[model samples]
Target: MRKLWLPLLVVVMVWMVAGNGEARLRPDFYGSACSNVEGIVRQAVRRKLNQTVVTIPATLRLFFHDCFVQGCDASVMIASARDDAEKDASDNLSLAGDGFDTVIKAKQAVEAQCPGVVSCADILAIAARDVVVLSGGPNFTVELGRRDGLISRAALVAGRLPGPDFDLDRLVSLFRLNNLTARDMIALSGAHTVGFSHCSRFASRLYSFNSTTAVDPSLNAAYARALMRACPRDVDPTIAVNMDLYTPITFDNVYYKNLLDGEGLFTSDEVLFTDRRSRPTVERFASDQAAFFRAFSAAMVRLGRLGVKTGGQGEIRRDCTALNS
Candidate 1:
């Protein structure tokens, strides 16, 4: 009886923490309070994205990182005085500054039109979609009424965000916890089509991935040579290279095509093609850009709903970087 009780108790705790009891989300959630919310966010995101092209992928990734850990509540944006908040987590350290800046700026813009009428959580969801559209990806509608989470813990990030080297099975297992499927995982990976990765994330593949000889045999020779030059043995860890070299600034199927040619920047990206269960999805996306866009847009909507807050579950934070005071 004791053994059975322990397992059941653990399951219940996990369910509760995952926000299984939160209010449902809807597209017209702010219809009465802020009818112009989406327009406000779209304008703000575009303005900031124009300042730096990197903002497109950064904002998209920011939404993923936030949704995975504790739902799309903007908990990732919370600041910790002790430096032990989600931002302190190593997995989150690579998140570009422009991503956070875009959210902050959007929040400020929304406030100007309808003070205290929008939640950072909803702003993040809408902004993420806008960034994807600006990058030439499909435009999808996001459900709103998400309230901001009050807790932000660094400890939760490690197990939440899939590592840069996660294999197919591992990626599937992690995303499943958030109601994401294998197809969703591959489609969402398409976001890599517009981002940049720091050398440190893939330096191992360029220099002694497994042995001391330097370079992974799975990588294409020409791509490896280029990577070596871009990321030298003693190069600064902060130095970055575009994830999609073929069309570095566009949101397209070239990323999957690169995988077919062995140009994937991270082991995690390459494995999608190597793993049988995921290979078909990768191939389909590579051969058809429209299909990839459709899948990606649908996946984004599903991801945006993970463990979301609605009604009075959370708050409408005045400052996006801090919880309500």
Candidate 2:
């Protein structure tokens, strides 16, 4: 009876946390306060997308980084004079300028119609989905009503994000700590379908990969050669490459197919297919675009719900780059 009681209590706690977040974040959360919220954001996002193709991956990556570090609160948007904000962190420094620009533009447009009624966090969430749809990916409703967090510290970002070299077990454990499962991790990884990674991030896999091999054996021979040409050791390591080689700019299920063909850019990505535990999911998503779309949408919703500060827990920052004074 004692053991059973503990398990039951844990289950109840998990259910309450998940249920409470969903209740607070609704699709029509701004229906009354800001009736044209989605439309305003869509226009702003479209404008940004038109100006630069980087908008698609940058904004999508921004949302992921924001949610992972600060629980979808847009705390990552804060800019500090002392260079100590979350965005100043090494993991976040690579986030492109276009992402910040997209959210800021949307926030400005939102404030024009409904001043102080919308949070930067919600705008970011909406903009993320908008970019995905604009980039030829799945269109899913984004839950709104998340408030911007006041705290943004560079010190808080370490180990919060998944790395390029993480193995399947490490990746699964990291996601699990955030109340996510292996399936969720794999599905979320599909975002790489339209993502980019810098050369330095995966240089080791291409050159000097231990004494056993020159290049990672998991990489397709032809793919490795392509990567080497694109990211020569003597050249700048900051040069960026698309995560999906086939559809470099589009957001689709090609990411999973790349994994099946050993073209996954990062070990963290290819591990999804190499590990027997997660290979089946990788294969399923690779073959069925509809299945991948459904799973991705569901995973994104779950990812957005992590550590959310809804209701009175957080504030609606007037300036996304700084907490309201």
Candidate 3:
């Protein structure tokens, strides 16, 4: 584990120094343009979460989905004429509506105060950070100045985003493409501590995973039985199960602990603990909340930097649900 940490740290440092000539994001991005950008996003997220706790996880997942597909731009919020946008992607259908609604509401609030100044992408980055803090997680500094993407085709989503069934190597390869290390991937996944997964996403484990496998042998028997009740063979696809049954509303290390106990809801998640390369980080995070929070914060900042748009590349979308005209 000690040997691994050095390599991971070097990778992160290299990423920090590398750039592609686009406008770089910074913590003080809106210092002069929209002094209250962070406050506006925080207030809107708090109000939405106050209305429904689900928005915390929803917003977090929303940010992840958006970044993974088309950088940190707000392309995921765009609605297409023929339902061909990123949001319409089959894998994205389960994203909680509350997440989109919260961003829209926050964008509206930002526009009211600093119309046409803050980008929807920046709003999402800030909102994601705020929601985590509001949910009892670490309050890390979030860089801003990301622009909204103009192109959001559903065709680009399939292979770009990691799925709920990926193995360790596949997951590592995916995150590495975005400049994230294996430790970063495990830490970022800790967000599952507060989210909900639809029955359809994990139903295979309860019924039949494949032609030869009836259930995932890694899952705890008692937990599997409970999941079966929550997600029967014929259960509606829309029905959801808390990702972390122990502390679904809190943003702690309980999700990692659950994985340690074979209570991970997704195969993608459990594979982290089972795979030797990532298992140490998973175990460390499960036992040390501070470590998880630190890594998660750093990884999120890295995620926010993935394929960002800036320096006249994109626009400050007036309406998050549609591209700027």
Q: Candidate 2 on 1-325: residue-level lDDT in tens?
A: 0111111110000000122455689899988999999999999999999998788888988988888886888988999999999999988888888999999999999999899989998999899999999989899988988888888999989999999999999999888877788999999899899867788788899998889887999998878887887778875655667777667678889899889888888999999999999999999999999998999898888888877888888899998898998
Arranged by lDDT, best first: 2, 3, 1
TM-score of 3: 0.92
After aligning candidate 1 to the native by TM-score, how far in Å is the CA of 196 from where it should be? 0.5
Local distance difference test, candidate 3: 0.83
Best by TM-score: 2
lDDT of 1 by residue, 96-185 (tens): 888899999999999998999899988988998998888888988788878998889999887888877889999998878888889999
Q: Put down candidate 3 lDDT per residue, 145-187, tens digits, no spaces.
A: 7888899988878888888899999988898888889888899
> What lDDT is reached at residue 277 by model 2?
95
Clashing pairs in 2: none
How far residue 313's Cα lies from its native spot in candidate 1, in Å, is 1.0
Model 1 worst lDDT window (10 residues): 7-16
